[model samples]
Target: MSATRPGSVTFVAVLVYINGVLNIIGGVVILFTRDQMVRASNAGAIAGITTAAILSIVLGIVILIVARGLLSGSRLARGLVTVVMILNAVSGVILLFNFQFFSGILEILWAVVVMYLLFTQRANAFFASRA
Candidate 1:
């Protein structure tokens, strides 16, 4: 438990922060343009878009909080992030079936890289020391 903080942790933290910010922004944008999306998709009601926007914003806040915990080397944060990444990867795969090929691939790759970084020897040691 004597190793210094690994670069992987810092890298993941930064990526998480960026992801959080993007999620929030995307949610807001989608919320504001709900009318357009509903019309374009011929979805009639705006209920679905509204729900998605809200969920995105909530997810963003949670991610931001987890990123903060991660920087501090919290074990719970690592677990939480791992779960989130797995969920994201699953969602990405689902999205691929819906024609979101580029984003889906990116999400899966991001999850894999984050998982690899988090479980590395140096990262594990860093978290152990913080405990």
Candidate 2:
């Protein structure tokens, strides 16, 4: 397999680390804030929190996977990152529209960073080297 550029690998690693940290934080909040969350007892709130926690965990896993792929200079990683970024952007927009407060802000930032990293010239060069 071709080696990835150090800069690209480093960039992706940073992204992965950030995503993992956020997921862990979100998970802890969801798991620990159950009582506070339950107090509202609104089915929609409960469902939304649950969904958010689950998605955070899943996104973390995906980020790790993509990081691995990127480190190995796999072309597939670019495609995966693209898909994930698109989904994140869409979700961020939806969350903003839904007025999810802090969560919306986080999602928007996440989407922007991911999109920037994935679309940058350095990222394209890294993928090209693999080809």
Best by lDDT: 1
Clash count (model 2, backbone only): 0
lDDT of 2 by residue, 9-110 (tens): 568667777767778678767856755877665878777778878777777777777777777667787677767677877787888898886787787787
Candidate 1 — which residues are off by over 4 angstroms?
Answer: 1-3, 39-44, 88-109
- Model 2, residue 102: C-alpha shift (Å): 16
Prediction 2 TM-score vs. true: 0.58
Q: Worst 10-residue stretch by lDDT in candidate 2?
A: 1-10
Candidate 2: residue pairs that collide: none
Give the alpha carbon lDDT tens digit for every residue of 8-127 in model 1.
999999999998999999999999999876676566468888899999999999889989988999999999899988998998899899999999999899889999999999999999
List TM-scores for all candidates, in order: 0.76, 0.58
